[model samples]
Target: MGEFAKRHQSPWPIIVCFALNFSKVVALLSPIDFLFYLFAGFTLAAGVGVITARNPVYSVFFLIAAFLNAAALFLLAGAEFLAFILIIVYLGAVAVLFLFVVMMLDINLATVRAGFVRYLPIAAVVGGIFAAQLIIMLLIWQQSETPPTLNALGNSPMNQPNNVYALGRVLYTDYFVAFQTAGIILLIAMIGAIVLTLRPRAGIKTQVISQQVSRKSSQSVRLVDLKLGQTHPTTAATAPTEPQEGSA
Candidate 1:
């Protein structure tokens, strides 16, 4: 039976048939579906490029491209608010910040890349663990009788506002604690970053709020009583004397 199967099999025919079927399916796709596929492809490619690009600046640009494609995907999925947030927060702020930091920092690329091999094992293990968890979750979701509901306030009726309202409602209600925690964590991270980057420079003048606040008027301004047409003695010594007409 194996010999007969091997002899009878013509892989080219099967390949051609599959190709034809794929082409037919592609032809059948709506414009929206085609655009979605295009965006998905760009997103995936840009995501890969972000990690693999040698230059940090290029990596940041790739990351920004990925963010843009992701926002496009979100828009396609009808999550307009998420799309805007991704564009505004990630593309506008985070990606630009990353680019600026990468450009501004004195990073030795060779030194940074030298440790890649050393860290590869740890990265592989962590990635494997994450992949396994994702697979398990996906399996569980696929086998589950009911699909998961993201909206805690229950599915909105067709007449109601779309994903934005649903997301806000659920976020402020069901996921409020998690959202607040995330905000607090981000705030702490921002503060930590500022603290780390701040360095006191020697010989640089800086504002002294305490000194300014505690100063007496006498220390800053002296009220001098002088007879008319008499200059202060210190000022008279420092002031340039008018050139004598007879001096050579």
Candidate 2:
């Protein structure tokens, strides 16, 4: 009891020691390196969650989390524009759209999961191919002799006044042709998707301009004289009749 009371009464020493050790570790790593590792770890964990989550909606949320952590990593790397793009475009728009769509869809989990085993061999082959490609790329990158390059604007990032200005300048000037080409490709893809998905369906109403132009008021409209209390005869005849309460 005395030992327990002593340990509980003077916990400040342990707290101070832990703080000192943490400060030393932070000093060795620097705040930037520490934050990079922190965000990177979070991004990695979120990516794993994205692939492992059973629910599509949960997977989308995990993907969003990964995007957010990646944005933080980008911010730490001084690419503020890319960071915000990840946040606003990918997270705010794309990921949220995916989440809502997944939630709204009537998905059959049993049907989806049933395909996993059947496709496992194909998936494994694809995964192995990708893994091999990645390993080869990593080895090639490690053996490359050329030093890292700067932004496309031929200026160091530190010298630029703002990231957006530098990025826009590079994109519009140095890579203008490639940028336009990408835009054209995206436009073509969008057109193809629209064409494929806009196929006509049965029982759908469509406008006919020539028919509308050739139509006359006399063909579509009817003028009838009726008493104030009487309904139109055509409507009266076409109306559905309800069953009498006791007759059925």
Clash counts for all predictions: 0, 0
Compose the digit string of candidate 2's lDDT tens values, residues 18-95.
468977655665466667657877999999998788887788989988999999977776778888988998988888
TM per candidate comes to: 0.68, 0.63
- Native-referenced Cα lDDT, model 2: 0.74
Q: Could you give me the TM-score of model 1 versus the true structure?
A: 0.68
TM-score of 2: 0.63
Point out where model 1 deviates above 4 Å.
1-23, 106-108, 142-160, 198-202, 207-231, 236-248
Q: Which regions in candidate 2 have their CA more than 4 angstroms from the true location?
A: 1-24, 128-155, 202-248
lDDT, residue 176, model 1: 88
Candidate 1 lDDT tens digits, 1-248: 11222343443553465468977756765566656767988999999998899898998999999999999987766667889998999888888889899999977779989999999999999999999999899678647543124433454321235767767666786678999999999999999999999988789988899977997654445455789998976546543333223222
Query: Which residue pairs does candidate 1 place in steric collision?
Result: none
